[model samples]
Target: MNNNAYNINIFSGGAELLFDNKRHYNIDLPNKDTWKLGDLLIWLRDNLLSERPELFIQNNSVRPGILVLVNDSDWELMVSSDLWYLICSLCQILCKYAPCP
Candidate 1:
């Protein structure tokens, strides 16, 4: 399961997880051969867009919470957001695999 094809550029690094600068984390990951495009839309709908009545209509959309955009388009509006997610997921999944300093 070597995932050398992907890497994520974080907006920040360190404990604060800030969002105004650039940072990066690289790790070996498994290939995303098992994922599909539909998975990305579902994740956006479940994790970002779906709204509760308590929130405003505009706020209901995940449009605001998107921390980053890959290749200019948001994953929610792509032919295969899953591909992006797969790459990003690899970042999360392999985070613990980092070598200790």
Candidate 2:
């Protein structure tokens, strides 16, 4: 499978703390034509998560507190386990999850 590049902008509301306090990333996901948002979450955990992975993902999905957006649209609007927008699934994900204070 070939690698595909995607960009995800993180906010303090999400897992930014685990990503070096950064907020922008251009990541790559394998393109076997079978990747989905669910798969992406796992990939993030395995490849990008720096610490406390449980904070971002749990029970095979993103924790309840976090909110996910794609192309400025709610991820729930498009969270299928199939190829979503072959144009750029991972490229347009924006996550928000305010850490408990």
Best by lDDT: 2
Q: Where does candidate 1 clash, by residue pair?
A: 3-29
**Which tens-of-lDDT digit does each residue in 4-83 have in candidate 1?**
43344443222112212224544333355644333433332343333341221234332233333454444554434333
**Candidate RMSDs in order:** 11.4, 3.4
What TM-score quantifies how close candidate 2 is to the native fold? 0.78
Q: CA lDDT of 66 in candidate 1?
A: 31
lDDT against the true structure, each candidate? 0.34, 0.72
- Candidate 1 TM-score, C-alpha based: 0.33
lDDT of 1 at 39: 42
Runs of candidate 1 with Cα error greater than 4 angstroms are 1-4, 12-22, 36-64, 79-101
**For residues 1-101, what per-residue lDDT tens digits would candidate 2 score against the true structure?**
23577777664565688777788888766656766677777788898888898888888778888887877887766656343433455457777886878
Error of 2 at 100 (Å): 2.0
